[model samples]
Target: MNGRNPILAEAPTEPMTGISLLGTTALLFEAPGETSLAVQRRIWSLAREAETWPEVREAVPGVNNLLVTWREPPRRLAAIVERLAAAWETASPLALEGRTVELPVVYGGEGGLHMADVVAHTGLSPEAIAEIHAAPVYPVYALGSHPGYCYLGGMDPRIATPRRKVPVLRIPGGAVSIGGAQTGVSASPGPSGWNTIGSTDMIFFDAARTPPALLQPGDSIRFRIAGVVR
Candidate 1:
């Protein structure tokens, strides 16, 4: 776990940096090994540092990855890549303590259109699945996919389901779904490849408000079992 964190203090040596370019405009850096909260903390640390640089327009954090967008596409591409890599080597964990949100979710019916799919995959009853799913206080890892959507961590791997081979054309807001080892709630109606097992009515995005996205990195979500549809 320490090897995965960018913190040179805890980790005697950093994992080999996964560096590449996103077209000509931005650079991508992926922390090696499986996704973990420790790695994401380092990402937060790196994002904080990189965002202040004169060359960076924004430093976006994803699951074990970071995207460094430039203020302008620099001519010194090699030099920029080097600098970014150097920054990652020195980054430390930025563990954030954020607010917790409890969402009342309805599992397995219209809201959870894909509950049967999950049941079949896990060989677990809907009741058991719902119990397992709501067991943890999941941390909001990153905000991506769509406006206000939160990528959550800490799902019980027993119920881990893969993303649908054929993506749903549209899923309503607050659609709770599991994709691979991760789980998240759809912020708005849109196409998704994840399996929707439940839903909550909470408004994840509000354009009319400040800091539009409902959840920030490090915040936690507790999924309350509002009801279970047969």
Candidate 2:
């Protein structure tokens, strides 16, 4: 992943670069290079605008791309693509006032199963690691990996660690882990390759809630050390 920090929105100056078909019904719109929040916001804006069109069924935004599925097979794919291109051209910069969620974490103990591994790789003391990791107010790039899970960006590079060679069979929900240049919180108990540094009590998903996901793209997160969990 590039060193670019994720943000909610930035000035829309970049142009729409490329488009590709996914299977038969989905169109993947691509921006230039490694995904950034600017590209993400643009994709999100375009996806939202595309929702108004009759041809669109769903518009899923990724890091640097937007996957749009058609409501029905169009008579001419070329024409639909052309319209989408037009929408992309005129789409405004995203202006969402997303919420900032504060998650209290218990770092460096049983909850942080891979804390020692991270210390070895980064050569940073456990306390230093906790300080650096908790410093940044990470941005939600997208929701993937699991239900209500968040792919956050803006982790301090000093604490960056690679994913495990062999994934753990089961990591409990609320596990705060770092994989490659990105970091995220697992929403449910599942297999993972990311190195767990801590855990939070935040409920990421609830079926009974109006919005099942506790976090959404464009939201911000600030992690605070809430004592150690032995």
Question: Residue-wise lDDT of candidate 1 within 103-159, one digit each (tens)?
Answer: 999999999999999999999999999999999999888888788989888999999
The C-alpha stretches of model 2 lying farther than 4 A from their native spots are 1-18, 228-230
lDDT of 1: 0.87
Clashes of 1: 0
Give, for candidate 1, the lowest lDDT window spanning 10 residues: 5-14
Task: Supply candidate 1's per-residue lDDT for 8.
Answer: 22
lDDT over C-alpha atoms for residue 9 of model 1:
33
Give all candidates' CA lDDT scores.
0.87, 0.82
lDDT of 2 by residue, 1-230 (tens): 56432221221234235877665677788766676677677777998888888878998877777788987655567667778888877776685568999999989798899999999999988888888999999888778767899878788888889999999999999999988788888999999999999999899999999799998888999999987543
